[model samples]
Target chain A: MMEATNAELYRLVLTDAPYVIGAYAILWIAFVVYLSMVLARMMRLEKEVDLLESAVSKRSGE
Target chain B: MKQLRTAIVLVAIGGLLTTAAFLMAFFTAEVQQFGTVTLEQEVDTVFPVAPDQFQPPAGEGIAYVRPWFSQKIFYFHVPVAEASFLVLIISAVFAIRFLTSKRAEFDTKSRIAMETALVFVVLTMITGVLWTRASWGVWWEWEPRLTTYFIMMLMMIAYFVLRNSIEEEERRATYAAVFAVVAAINAPISFMITRVIPSNHPVVFQPGMASSNLLPFIIGQIGMLMIGYGIYTARMTEERLRERVEIAKEALEG
Candidate 1:
């Protein structure tokens, strides 16, 4: 009976492995998503600044 | 440009260090044993074995303990949690400066810091939940430590909502700054409450971590702080560019 119980516990541990993997997956995904959002915002802002600078120079020349 | 360059370097270094820490955790650190597993071994006695003796002496071994997978999450969760609180304190410092100086620049700094804090807080919550679920078999609990953190998260979100609701720029900054200060106060209270109240959360430092465990933890901490600072600087650069564009437009109009 004791041998069977120990074997069962070990099997449970193996079954629980996926939860551990899931936790790490969520962590990496959250960081990557945030990084991408920041990068996208930066690109949008850069385009806006370029357009505004060109507009300012064009108007000043006139 | 120089600030952006520095931020990039910090992020790259942080990434490398964190990867190294993760490797060490899996390959080098000892798996902490929490419960005992009984083992039967031969008993050597001075006298001859008696017929009444049914079994041999019991021996203890660390290898018999079940694998502690949840312990691995500690390396990441703790560093993120500490970084979140530190950033909150920094945001409050900028908030106080803004209140006294009433400079838009100070306000912008405070707001950016708070934004960084928000990101960390969210990450902390997610990781905390994962750890709790893995260890305790529950996804959510209303324990003091967790409840305090939930309140802190709400207050942070409310700070941004308050800023958005107000139309006047100065009034918005003032309200947000005050809220940030309140959030700062809440942060330490939340952290200390865990110590005051007994909780299931393992105290990693109370009993000194093994040197093998300490190395990865330290590496993770430094890496996490670098990433936090990198995120903050990147946002700051974007905000500054937006401000410059607004100024150029105003000059054109003038």
Candidate 2:
């Protein structure tokens, strides 16, 4: 009984390797980018709060 | 410091177990055989039964059915997939607690758990795609498991999207918590429906597994759970620190 060869099976599977790899790579990159954006926004908000505090202190002093 | 120590310990143990599982999968588990074949020099040769001389003995199969790399992927894939679902459930539990108690800590825990689940879900999707591509001919298929996972991936992404769209902290937490519970509930149903409605995709789970295969799988699962718990704890600690910082800033302003 002749069955499907290993090479034939390998060929069938190998074609989709790139797609799988590409999908994962893209997801990881997106996650990192989103994290960076969130960090940046938090920093900006902190700066704004500091500016507001200094302004209020100066007004009260005046 | 105590929490940090716990996190480090859990991570270390998890890493060690994962490594051990990988080694066991390769060296200990029996190589799975597919079917009997008759060797022929001609590529197109097809026969019901090629002569005895052409056959390699019944016991002496090919060196390996699947490649070493493909088989290795299985260890990581199944573990991460299981961990992702477990974390999702944890997140939903926290979400329910938050809704009932209206406690900030529960909300924080839920959010962190969801984030951890997201990381594992992405890992699951990647490994799943690789497995499918290797085992089946196609890169993407609308099989039950794949479809359900794809839906889960989207739902998780949507949870984050919903979070970003909301500005108020408490409101954001509440809405996210609600959504998390709904998504979590949907996950199992998705799995069940998919399995019930059969498709072209092959069902790999058999009635039982050999001891060698079972051991590695269990080890991998335990390691994955520990790693997931560690990540959740670490993220929660970071969030607590951020909250403290925010409170201090508010105090200074007030």
What's each prediction's clash count?
0, 2
In lDDT terms, which candidate is top? 1
Writing each residue's lDDT as its tens digit, candidate 1 over A1-62 gives 12324454456455545665666677678777887887788788888888989999999899
Candidate 2 structure quality by residue, lDDT tens digits, B14-74:
8678768877877897544433343333343222333455456564432223233355556
lDDT of 2 by residue, A6-43 (tens): 46545534554454445435534544454445445545
Mark the regions of model 2 whose C-alpha exceeds 4 Å error after superposition: A1-62, B34-38, B41-69, B200-206
Of candidate 2 chain B, the 10-residue stretch with the lowest lDDT total is B39-48
Give model 1's docking category: acceptable
* Worst-scoring 10-residue span by lDDT in model 1 chain A: A1-10
Error of 1 at B82 (Å): 0.6
| Residue pairs with backbone overlap in model 1 | none
Q: Individual DockQ of the candidates?
A: 0.41, 0.14
Cα RMSDs, all models: 5.7, 6.7
